[model samples]
Target chain A: MFVWIILIPILIQYTLTSVVPMLISFFLTFTDWNLVGTWNNVGLDNWKRLFSDRAVWDSLKVSVIYALYSVIPTVVIGLLLALAVNTRKKGTAFFKSAWFFPVITSVVVVASIWKWMFTAEADGIINQVLGLFGIEPQFFFGTRLALITVALLGIYQSVGTAMVYYYAGLKGIDTNLHEAAKVDGCTGAQVFFHITLPLLRPTMAYVLITLTSGALKVFDSVYTLYNQTGGPQNAANTLVMHVYRTGFFNMQMGYASTIAYLLFAIIMIISVIQYRITNRDVE
Target chain B: MKKRILNFFFYVICILLCVIFLFPFVVMLFGSLDGETKYAVTLTSWFPTQFSLKQYQSVLSVGGRMSRWVLNSVIISVIPTITGVFLDALLGYIFAKKRFPGRQLIFWYFMAAIMVPYQATIVSNYLLYSWLGWINTYWAFLIPGMWTVLYMFMMRQNIAAIPDALLEAARIDGAGEWRTFLQIVLPVSKPGLSTVAIFSFMNNWNNFMGPLIFTTSEKMYNLVVGLSSLNQQSASFNMQMTAGVITFIPMFLVYMAFQKYFVDGITVGSVKG
Candidate 1:
């Protein structure tokens, strides 16, 4: 009875904030409503259109690439960085906090900073650097480079959290394992690959799933960096942005819901599979 | 000797990496003063070409609306964060210490809800907020995001670490539940509370999406939304970076001061999330 008293407020809030909204979003997927119209049944038309829609298909492709590009490098580099800083030595704290700064920063702040750096002009910081190597200025926001540049920003922001998680995972590995491996005359590299790598599997799975999900739903960077529009010719457009533009900007709530549901399905399927694999029963 | 050499190599790389990580911030800091200093970056150096507070002054001016945005960000972030800390800790206490009928079921429901991504809420939330006339109001942000499932999980885990005997003893002393929670549970759980508070503040202060969708007026816009959209009004990178620095300062100071909680939070958070 007492527990219910404590849970009541949050429960009511969650129901209104999350549960009801999600069900409404799901229902909106089937309707023919735009913002101004009364939503009636659209039958399977939206689903059929979603299947054949070229822009949605393209955004999906972009999202996948963005996820892979950001997640893979962040994991690999972050793990390596974590290992490097896993020491209990002086100044480790400073280094840890330094890298972790970006993780706490608002995406808009970081995007704003990076936008100035990657400006398409010849005088832009990055282009100026490239100029020293005898290369012409590159238009980072152009079709050729917009998505990749965005991915780099995403990767930069994520690496810190991944490193922190990996560091914790590394610290949790029993020192005795290293001692035993050393007694067996293993090299440092050998011990890491043989012992530390296997122990960090759970951390890797968590980081990968989060990084992938974050990448899939990425909107702030794209929205901010390119100024509400995706990028030149929609090259940097993502599924989330598509949904936002369709629903809010274009006021096509039903169509936006359809895209959102598709995204939700993709994310759910991936997460379910990940959960099944990662949560194998010890029983 | 070989071990010494390897250690040297590691530290060198780590230092270089830290420098690379901080380079962008350095640019922002110096670039912020660029307006009055009449300086921009050169390959020769990334330092302030000249020093001036003109950019910061302009950013702080009423016309910039940067100060108002900062105040708005504070209200939006701080109120929710403070409220969330209490609510999150309370939920954590109940879920962790109390075992009543349907407790596990309720806990699992929240756990499942955590898996639903933010994108799932955007369309309906927008429509819902619009219909509620919550667009352009802080209520949209507070209502949905006032308390987070992530913080609840963190608090639950933290409080659960305290042995039941602590609570049992408090009860045996004839202490009321509120008294026990306030004097005993809260003191012991300061670290958890701080962790939740820091994360809550960070997320709220930097939150762009909720404000972007919910509020259209300049007065209600938080720093992230207002700061990012500054290019629409002015193309000056110096002034913009100055505004960015203004936004970054509070979070940075809080982080430095409360570094312990952050380290503790990550270690425990890894196991659950």
Candidate 2:
């Protein structure tokens, strides 16, 4: 009875998070409700309109572009960092923790720093760096280039996570195998391809899934740096951002729920596809 | 001799990599010290010529209603972290050691929660909170985050690694499941518990969007949202960086104090069960 008492409170807390919101969302999806007014039953109109919304499509495209820009660089650079640091004999912990710093820093802080870096004036870091080579200061945030820059920042922030995972993976391998390969006259390069790359597949698989999910949910930096407009040309407006704009900013609650569900469906489908591909490859 | 040279090369590479990763943080630290926006505008100035605490003061002194927001954040974050640690351990105990009907199904349901993005349900969550009179209350933040499905799963993995004989002996000695959990399972899984605690605390501390949508008033905002709004409302760079500095301090201090734990917490899956 005492255990049950302890259990009940905890269960209530957990279930509230999942159950209450879920029940509310189910009802809200079929209604014509904005936050300010009384809700009315709208049937499937919100769902239907969601299918053809131009902003939704545009944002979806931006999401895909944003995901691609962040995910690819994150994996590659993260792997290289892991591989580089794995070779280091001393200060590995320091380097590893250094890389991991951005992972913990608030998104707001990172966004602010990046905004300053992307400043349009000649004093901006990128502009100043380019000025030495005589290139004019480019308007980064006001163009499609701004989206890519924001995406780059996202990659920089998250690649550490991937690196840590890969580093852990590298540590799990048998040192004897590397030693044996070296004795067989195989060059470091040759051994890495034949041994290290293949052994790192499990870590790679985890990285792929995580980075993909993270990419799909891109929001904070873009929202902060771009002033919630999704950057110049709406290039950084991801599906998550679209959901936020519709739900909160625009106060179109029902429509936003519909959009959220759609994004959920899209992510599920993509995850399923990736899972099948990876499972086949692993087998 | 060859190994020594290789080690030297490795250290140099590691140092360079550290610099690359730490550059932005270095910049941020310096940027927050600028006395004027003009000084900050000069991006190439690696060091701040004029250092001042003026920004930090302004952020903290948004003065009247801002302190309430900080208090709200503290309550919201603390309640969830403490409850999540206890509940996650409880559920994890049941799943890890308990032989019960339909356990796998229950476990998978919890796992599935992780894949379902908050973006999907946040709209409804907002409505639910308002309807229940939870909006603008700490309950809105505390309730939604308590489940921590991922943490439960992690604890299960860690707990499973423990010897079953220890738990069985406790059970045989007339200890009930609950006592067994507190005595044997909980103590044995300290590292795992620590991992969960750190993560939950950090997430709750850093969360912005959850509080943003649920809390209707400025007084209900978390530190992240408070700092974000402060940044937006501040007219000058000095004020904004000060806010950034104040916001950065607590978490930074936490990280520095619990450096080893933080490192292990992050690398949990790789380092241990």
Best by the TM-score measure: 1
Highest DockQ scorer: 1
Compute the lDDT for candidate 2: 0.76
Locate the minimum summed-lDDT window of 10 residues in model 2 chain B.
B264-273
Report the Cα lDDT for residue A281, model 1.
23
TM-score of candidate 2 chain A against the true chain A: 0.92
Q: lDDT by residue for model 1 over A1-283, one digit each (tens)?
A: 6667768877888888888888888888788788886888988788889999999999888888889888999999989878877876778878888889888777877888787677777887888889999999999989999999999999889899899889877887899999999999999889989998988888888788767877898999999888898788998889998889888888888888889987888888877866664556221
lDDT string, candidate 2, B63-110, tens digits: 655566667767877788888888888888778877766678667756
Compared with the true structure, what per-residue lDDT tens digits does model 1 show for residues B1-273? 998998898789889989878888988888886634423444444466578888877779876678889888988999999889988888888988886888888888887776787876788998888888998888888888778888888888788898889888999999998988888988999978988888888888888888888788888888888887785565577877888898899989998899777766665444433
lDDT value, candidate 1, whole model: 0.83
- Give the count of colliding residue pairs in each prediction: 0, 2
Candidate 1 stretches greater than 4 Å from native: A133-136, A281-283, B1-8, B35-46, B62-64, B267-269
lDDT of 2 by residue, A97-192 (tens): 788788877888777766666678998887887899999998888774877887878887898888877877787889999999999999999999
lDDT at B249 for candidate 1? Answer: 93
Please give the TM-score of chain B in predicted model 2.
0.83
